[model samples]
Target: MAHSRLQNINNLTTIDAKGAGIYIHIPFCKQACHYCDFHFSTSLKKKDEMIAAIITEIGMRKNELEGQVIQTIYFGGGTPSVLSNQEIQHIITAVYNNFTVIDNPEITLEANPDDLSNKRIAALSNTPINRLSIGIQSFFEEDLKLMNRAHNAKEAEDCIAAAVKHFDNISIDLIYGIPNMSNQRWLQNVAKALQFGVPHISSYALTVEPKTALYTFVKKGIITAPSDEAAQEQFLLLVDELEANGFIHYELSNFGKQGYFSQNNTAYWLGKKYLGIGPSAHSYNGTTRSWNVANNMLYLKSIQEGKLPSEQETLTLSDRYNEYIMTGLRTIWGVAVARVQQDFGQLYYDYLIAQLQPFLDNGLLSFKDGIITTTRKGKFLSDGIASDLFFLR
Candidate 1:
């Protein structure tokens, strides 16, 4: 079954997502890499305490869901690879005991290439986690050093070999457009990842975000800012290479090898209701959205005092419509005009139709099966166009 045709007014205050997905945040890492801005501390100082609290929070927040079948369970992290097999299993068991997980739910765990030693891979094989997303940002030694990623070229290649022996649903991440990278090396990186025969690959163009170590270094003239022209050229080339190698360009930065899409993430892009647990985790229950504190200490203290440790807002009609436009436009499924009308009323329906006519006339978009999606050219400017067609009222 698919998610909802409707986007508003689900049974809120009903514990559990009606067709919810469960996301457990494993927020501890061995080191902080440059160009990384996610909320994780290098100190595993409170690792044990945090792990215990996450499980506790699951039980405490269990009633927030509706006892529906959980379609996916994803262990996203500071680096879930840092977690022990015992810790992983303990969390999985906690989820099973507290919630009604569906039969054959897709459980994915994200890892780092350096952590994928033979012993660890073999240990992970024994767990229920059927999928592994290894962060192989680049296969070039210089790029790895520049980004301060925890893996070398050898580890990048070897980790996949280790993982493939034990898991079929494997996805590897690659970051392209490094200032020091050449086209030849980028091509090699793509070829090497494909050589492992992994089912999915998520390739991203590197962007220097604010307050990151890379940002600081660039500001101090220690390193150059990202080259936009090079980034664009590399992205185009990467797409061509992957598509030629039989990968589907499922999303802007994601390509799936056949039927191996990341079900958990795909659900999020499609706006499925998923509950996030842990510090900095966000939860959606249809109309209102909530997120826990990003600070580990703040989250732990609040939950200890019997508070949800979260902030929430009820989504307005326009907010929901704009959200639908953004998420739905980025997918292969496209935006279904009829479904929008059914959920958001005819004024929204008519407004979108009228707004899109210019793009439709310009051949930047196409219409069929009562849905509208950007053509390949328009997809490059998808964000701007999607916003243009949104209902602002």
Candidate 2:
């Protein structure tokens, strides 16, 4: 792992300017949520073996990283919380043994409500895990039931209190703009999180992914399909409320109090390289991107046979520039025109300025210094703007 950001006050594109973040994916969930499509299994038959394999994978790939320092380690999941304290420690310890961890590297574990009981929370608090990303989704029982989430409303509300007693760097995830979720109810969810003093929150709209239970339910009329208008309204409401409360909307779906932005995810938005381990995990190193097999069983089997079950592609310069525009345009950081010119050359710079004229005239984009950023209205339609600005060459 190198530094996750360019902090040397010198060159920005130097390889060492950004250190790598390590993401360890755990493909086991206690139960499936109606809307989730991430790879995982309810079965724990091979859970122990899976842990060993994960640790082994880290050790084996240590050389691939060429002894780089790891600045952040994130255990994202089907539900990393499903792994016991000992299991979690094993994975962390293995990484420590194989790679050089940066001083005070950000170590995060994505957990759920049901797993945060006093005992379990205490066990986790005892480890090097300092941050928790809880899946609260909604604070209403009816909403929880509709999503078939593993935990109920009570669990969702209480888990944060328990977690806060142990860790201050807590981030709660919420879903707004679900089908028929009223503005008032969304307000209640936000208020509940703020009342608990959660340092960070990641809230998102409920979009229907293909082959998900939520998608099928909507198609069959068992559940109403998500509404774009309501989602947009709710998103606006969330942004206004959180910002009023002194939270910064650092990225599109994320809000952090003061300096608590998600370090691992920030590395991602800045186009830093990272190694993603486990089923369905993704890796990008500025030049290339790769992903693992989505099947847990197959993933385990492939790695066991001394082969990583993943596909890789080296990124073209255009691919990297387009990706930078796509991601950087979504955050408060926006796009630096000088940096763009330096990396992509004057031709790309001319192309970007040409594209910016309409958006600027429409009040959706602004120019200051040598950077171009979206206005508030631009954020709501960021995807379309990014599509228009993408360099196909």
Candidate 3:
């Protein structure tokens, strides 16, 4: 059955990802990473309540999608693997009962190396979750310790070996640009990931976000932050190595073998509608964007009282255009010229074209086939270049 599904993977995965996707955020983790700022609690005291609240939110927001077929169901968070298989399935069952899910939806669960025990992997294989996105930030003791991850180097390599036995559609995340990490170490990390034969790899440069432990340490001169030069060199090396290994650089921080690009993220990048349930999850339905409150206890109380604690913002024309530039520049699909003209207006399109000349001359961006895409030299600088092209309204 697994082999057959792998063969027919594209049908199950999001093709063009036009349909809406579902995002369920799990906000409990065994431990906190030093450089992280995502909303999550180390304590699992309210995990049961949190799951119930997520299910309630799904039921309440079912109508928000207006019967759009759900193509993808993503379990992302502080380590979705912290929940039992039954807990994961309960949320999925609620989705089916309240929402319109198409046949063979692409369901993904984000897990950490420490949580993916052999027994856990086998148990998860029995659930409806078809894909695993492992957070193997690094397969080195020094790096893992630097980030304060729960799993050590051996567990990182071991979990992938175990997970691939049950899942062919697997993606593992690797982080580069950690303080004191050499290019040699970065190359070895990527090489170790490739040795596992995983189909997808997501890599990111470590940054010190404010309020994170790393930030405080850096502010106090207890730790040095990753350098921009080091990050750029490592990122380029990552792209070169992964692409040479037959992986497609589908997005700025994502690479996948053919037919393995992340459907949930693809839907998001293409501006398709999605409903994000659970605390701190964000939702978009064409015109307006909304996000749930980041407070777990408050979210639980509000949902139990039949109210959703979320904030909504209606998108303006300028808001939509700027978003397009940012997401498009980071993706393999460049900003479509005709889309800018038809969706925004000639004025917006002209501004985009006007901004293109400078990047074009400097070989940072290229315009071809009525589309604008970043050049190799500009890939690392994609975010900065996209900001420069933004219509600051």
TM-scores for all candidates: the values are 0.92, 0.95, 0.97
Report each candidate's C-alpha RMSD, comma-separated, in the order given. 5.2, 3.6, 1.8
lDDT of 2 by residue, 81-179 (tens): 999888999999998998878777778999999988977887777788878899999999999988899999999988888888878688999998787
Could you arrange the candidates by TM-score from highest to lowest? 3, 2, 1
lDDT comparing candidate 3 with the true structure: 0.90
The candidate that achieves the highest lDDT relative to the unseen native structure: 3
Candidate 1: tens digits of C-alpha lDDT, residues 120-230: 988787788888889999888999999998889999899888888878788899988787788888888888887888768887778898989999998999998888778
Clashes of 2: 7
Most accurate candidate by TM-score: 3
The backbone clash count of each candidate, in order, is: 6, 7, 0
Candidate 1: regions farther than 4 A off: 1-18, 361-363
Ranking of predictions according to lDDT? 3, 2, 1
Query: What value does the lDDT take at residue 176 in candidate 3?
Result: 93
Q: CA lDDT, every prediction?
A: 0.82, 0.85, 0.90
